[model samples]
Target: MKRIARVILLLLLVAGLWLALKPTLGNRRLTFLPQHWSEYLDYMDFWLNLGAFAILGLTVWFALGALEKVLQRLCLMIGSITLMNLFLEAMQSSIPGRAMDRADIWAGLLGCILGIATGLAFQLFAVRKKSRTTSPQVLFLDQTGRLGGAELMLLDIAAARAADSEVALFQDGEFRTALENAHVKTHVFKLGEEASAVDKQAGVASALASIPAILDLVLQIARAARAFDVVYANTAKSLIIGGPAARLAGRRLIFHLHDIIADGHFSSLNQKALIFCANYCARKVIANSEATKAAFIASGGRADLCVVVPNGFQIPEERTSTAKTSALRSSLGIQPAAWTVLMAGRLSHWKGQHVLLEALKSVPTAHAILLGDALFTDEDRLYAQRLHTQAEEPELKGRIHFAGFQSDTMPYFDMADAVVHASVFPEPFGRVIVEGMLAGKPVIASRAGGAAEIIQHEQTGLLVDPGNADELAAALLRLQTDTAFSSTLARQARQAAQDTYALDAVQEKIESVIRHIAGSNKSQLLSPAIPLPKPPPCAA
Candidate 1:
């Protein structure tokens, strides 16, 4: 179907271009040239040229298909069409009865702009039609609008499902902007205003205070849930609020477990409450890693209701030139010969930005770049300040650089010799570990939680004890000194990442789970569990 459409568009473009330029081509000679813009406007030939260019522009726009960026699409359409029309008009000046005029160029530009607008409108209408006819309607509920690891993962999932899904954010923040940029339909529940302000440290008291607000938000979600086939809860807070709402609306609920809901990260009471919600309300539980699923089950979540689905990433196209990498290093004042190690995540203590800093002291020749900032909580802010103070210490000065939060970290990944994951606590899923692997960088990750699941020790990548600076430092030195060993690991890791964590494969698995629950009868929703697939050999 797509090939046919492209062929038709190509034919139209060819015909339009021929008709628009015919007057200035072949045996035509220069005569009766229009000296003024008014003279060009009076000629009926001007409108024919303008209409031909408009058709040409519209055909070009349709041929481009659905581009991820609207601005880039518009620029390509308008700029290319306008330049082509202007060049053709200039050519017309040398031909008889084919006079060049500024008015003709302006008319063509206006027509191209109108054509682009028309193409965009048609594209939107087609999207709506496809959503209604082919795809399942999904309502995604997320707790915070902050762009944390889970939120970033959610954005990827939402982007994959955007053709038929609507995302509801509990509170407004940067994640909302990201969703909008991805062209995903998003809604912010204003009732979550008070709930969003509550501090993470407030514990049980915070939960108690947010109940009324949560209930109000639940009512809003329940009403919205009626229109969707699946209610996907992307966070613990969302599962708590949206699970009941999904139940109220008689819709299938899928809980996306992104964290280790254990006593370390959550209080005992909170852990129990989370388990209760998952076991009782949610029809299916999608754990980001096997480790997360194990933790959830250990905390009394129903094993039958859970399935492990690791996060996936798209391997970015490799840079053909080293110019951009060199520019990035120079801008950061990093020595060209220095061994650069990168650690990317929010600058929270548990994320272990300080731990990475401490390890850098042992590897004096290596420079470290921390690629994220404190995005949520007062504790995270203080933690970031402490990391800065620690980095300023005599031993660490000039060796460690804080690059802060970057929306695009791929360039930094390319600049690094090795990527490190130094989380003090067990991470639910270390996205950076796989990302570095995909970039073909030797990843030295913590030998705990999901990081362990990603790296196959010395075979694929190196793993060290969590929070142990000495072990991390030793691993870094080993990679720097042992050139052949590091290259082998990086090569294997890259291949493993491509085989297991490609976005298309993972999204299909997730979509299947959603469709299964959505299609199941109400009585069978919780009774028959989707059997957990065996973990990948590298993960095992």
Candidate 2:
């Protein structure tokens, strides 16, 4: 479709050039379409030129297709087209009987605007068509193909509903392949690198630029969403586009919020937009933790729109034997007597790998194994390098192990004396904390946000002030020396995991939310969600 649009745009540009630069037959100045009411009105020629320019605008706008990567390509395409039109007008001055006209420029610009509006109206109309498929109860939307925490969770959700659901992703990666491996019907609709690159730091201009691509993807998803009873967005980006698509398709929208919508994590513009979409569009907002829910409420998000749902985790009935865990410990070459601290997560600044390295300096007897790697970007890779430099220091030499990213973290977890989550920021939901507990190890997580919600100080696990290496060091020492206490904490933590974050209960709760809203009528056009709009007065 985009290829064909580009061809039409090229031909329109050629026709525009001919109209502006073609010599007049009489060799006198040609003013076929008079702009003023005073001059003899050439209504026929006037309408003809206006129609031509309007078609030009439509083709240009369509050629730009979703204006992906507004920062670079969007600016380039628009600037190039503007320069082309201006150059053609300039060339008309060189013609024997023609001259560049400012009135023409103004008319062309207006035509372009009208063309873009028409294209948008068409897309909006396309969404109003109701879905006919009713067998698939849900449609899951995710923006990235990478297996982040959210993708991992979605894998479980989609897999459970593989018989009656489909996953639509914006990019292609292991996440898609994994879904296919799990027998979950998956489709990839590439949203281009330009659109995906617009991150939380992106300003209003960048977002405005990405709208073309956002809308394009939304239209595609909305069309597909018509077949399903519900639309589920697993990431913030997905929610931004999916929310509108679901509403347009007359389907119930559910936003599975994985990030805490805050200035610290997202730009102010993003925070407002997310809260707006959730409040006005979605039937339910499934927050991973109460901390996530609190942050949502604090950020102008409606309090009643959110429902806290912890990511479900379950311990295996047949646990790895002690011998296997000991073997993993021996492979790392640290002495068996050395206290081991295990932290598993992507190696990023906020994930606190650096702080954990600093804390190790205060606990001389401890050895640390850092699992997970910088999954994306050069910044994280540099962070990993700095960590290596920290490990090479005399006091920390031969103690810190960089295990990198592991497909399976169970053996590493089994070998650990304690699992530490040292994120500098408040985590939305500490997957590592529950993971450690499921592995039957004591957990010490930063005491804020969702991590704080998971651990009771000195009970199931310990919590320290975020980013404080000294406090973290103290917690490590306490866990290392107090074997009996650590064992108790691990046992209590395991119980806590089984009761609250058990996989069965977590999936069941989420499925229940889906079941409740899946029956909503899909024939009706878009309408404002509850709490955002007051209910109509009841008939007595």
Candidate 3:
């Protein structure tokens, strides 16, 4: 019915625009009105303009995409619709019987306001009319629909709880398609420029200035969250909106801390803001790594609120298919006997794609397949271009496969002999490292932060110093040179990953935390923390 109404309104808009632009009909008949209807009013044209444009504005509103329903977009549409009508009104100057009238312009403006109000009221009423019993049990909030480490982890968690939870993304991208592909319910509640302008590096003034946009998003999320038992924020940006929304909705909030909230990762002001929100709003903070948890506490976040939980990576069993692996290798131009190393992460300076390229300089004949794309910022895009240039250089030419972003990296993983984690800085929790382990490939991870905590030195996987190309190169050389040791490392890492980071086990641990927090009613100060499962004992 709504679709039919929208179509009729659109057709009415086109007809009305056509009639308004056409020359005035000379007394044959413009209306089927009791021909005496205009006898009662002197401003019949003004009323016609009002009614026509009101319907026109409503039509425009309904025509907008769901993500474009924010105030910024609405205002743009309203302004455009008004200007179009005014232009038609001005074109009246060219007609003999019609002249531009200020009254007609005023009527159009009034009609647009009415239409905007009606549309917004109808949307709000729809939400308010929904019963709490019918709402999703869990409302998961995420900052972006770009598949970063945090987002990938969130996808796994949300997919596991698809029957009871729904994810709300701040922006739209491939993440939505991933969710749909995984059979998980998802929605996009887009944030406009103001919300985006205030990033992790934003100062206090920038944050203060974005309050209006923040508050608006909060209200919307709060209204929708009233039915959910828990409001789970999947990223730092999500916390900015989810914290206040959860408070308003009177629901327990879970902050899944994916970042190391320290000097390099965030501005001092943003660090303070994150601490303030987590302390005040979150019932429980689920930190991805001990480094992340420690950083949160060091930056003034409450220690009692945080609990460390590793990211549960859902590895497809089919990634182990040797036939598919060989096909991928053939497609990517890896020689049958070439030693290929796989590095997967977004293209950013801190992620050290440059370091990997430099390391490849030392390991001359080794081929590297770089997965992931520049998902955010102009800087990253620039870096990506530079990488392409670097890849073309003499020592590295054709040896590096710049295989941009791959939705399912499993095939790429299957094609590689070893997986590398090359972040220049401390990773909060190395999702790719665990993924490498699960894929049954030898991994050489940066020896800092969660990567240090996950690998049991040379027993399970090799660890290299962060940003050291020589160390990375040497590890690459050793993995290629000593095939038996590499196979042993891969076997042990796979066993450890299977025992500790299995989907069902990790999901149940997190669900326990969620249930404990949600059922507490603020009675208990903290829920029992889920300890990292013991790594399987390794061979000598």
Candidate 4:
């Protein structure tokens, strides 16, 4: 119905424009037109102009893809149509038998205002209909509100489902701001005291110490879940806290598993606890990659409830211009002759910034940029400081640059000759690998968990053994020395990323999983799951 309405509006717009411009194309007498300004209000041409411009304004409003706010869309339509009317009126004076009339412009302006008002009414009606029928109420829960890979992924999910979803954050930070900017309603739960960072290394005792705070958070989530049809746990901590809360509210729980629940990534205690919560509290579990799913099952998670659904990425709308890229590189003090490499992620020990620095020693001509900051705990901060100290060593001295915590990593990606991922431990999903591929850069990633799943060895990209600086250095040097091979790898990687990891594809899969859970009865939801067909290849 909306498409048909838009088509009709477009046809009307074309006819109106043609009618308004017809007289200006030829030498036509304007004797029928008003002789005075007061007479313009009574003239047929005045009404025609008003109707034409009104249609034009409505067309513009309907053609808009997505606007964050209704008022912003209305303003855009009114301003655009007003300027177009003024230009048309100005052109009348230059035409053979046409006279520029201020009254005509006023009529058009009035029409534009009316059109915007009409558009607002239509929007309100559509929103109401959507709320009543189409839009499902979803509650998204995340433990941390900070911007990390998982947090970024959660932002994308919330943005895609913003029409019917509300987000609940355990702690408030930049991620909450991102969700709000995307027009998703966000609520932040405050613990009475600062909560400890949730990490496997923190041990079960450390987590137990925050029991009071966790209980308070669980209560808040349960209350919020009651208003929503489905509760989505977007991270590890969220699964632990939101799982039981969802059960309490009698809401379907879908846990998005973005971690590898194995000894390499999580301690045995943390892994067992996560599996227990998922099996007992969650109706379904969506893993970010096959590796993540396998790890979860190996840790004794219920395989019947789990399915693999990889992270989606978007190709950059426009490639960075050469001039802008040069300017950025110059600002960063990168030498023009130097081959630049970028490693982007939070500066955690397992993420491998330190490993990248060690590898850089073998590639003397290549300059390295570390584009992230330590997040969460003081331990991460100290680890970052140690990396800084490591970069100061004689081998890496002038070649390594720590470009701390970039909110936007695209500029660095644009400036780099290649991108590297060198995690010492297994990753649940490596978002940076796909991002680099989307940017059309050759990626060299560790050959351990999800990164291995993303890069097809020498096919899509080069994969080195995790924690092996020698192999990483070799891959880097190969790219630097072999331009043709590098370009071929980049092209293939980009194609793979676009084909499998596009945002819409992943969102569709996730929505299907949620809908399945939401539609099922408690008995059906917990029954033995049939084996899911393998997902199409993706960067995860």
For each candidate in the order shown, give its overall lDDT on alpha carbons: 0.81, 0.81, 0.82, 0.80
Query: Would you list the clashing residue pairs of candidate 3?
Result: none
* lDDT, candidate 4, 1-540, per-residue tens: 458658877787676565455553223333355456424533577787777667666665666622233455566677777787778768767766567789888989988787656665676566456545765678998888789888888788889889889999888888899899999999988754434365765576777787888888888889888777789999888888898898777677999999988766677667777888888788789999998999878777778889999998756689888888898888888888789999998898889888889888999889998898888778789999999899899988888888887777788888899999999998888999999999999999999889998989888999988899999999999999999999999999999989989988898888888777765622232232333344222212
For model 4 the TM-score comes to: 0.72
Per-prediction TM-score: 0.72, 0.72, 0.71, 0.72
lDDT of 2 by residue, 36-72 (tens): 5313333344455556666876676567734122234
Error of 4 at 130 (Å): 9.8
Q: Point out the worst 10-residue segment of candidate 2 by lDDT.
A: 522-531
Q: What lDDT is reached at residue 165 by model 1?
A: 95
Local distance difference test, candidate 2: 0.81
Candidate 2 regions off by >4 Å? 1-136, 522-540
Give the per-residue lDDT digits (tens) of candidate 3, residues 1-540. 458767887788778776776665443224444546634443477887787678777766666612212556667877887898789878978976677888989999888777766765666455445423333378999988788888888888888788889889888999999998889888888788777767778877888888888888899999999767789999888998999998777677999999998887888777777888888888899998999998888887888889988888665656557788787888988887899999999988888889989999999989999899998777789999999999999999989998888876778887899999988889999988888999889999999888898999998899999999999999999999999999999999999998888877888889888777755633321222322233222111
Clashing pairs in 4: 372-405
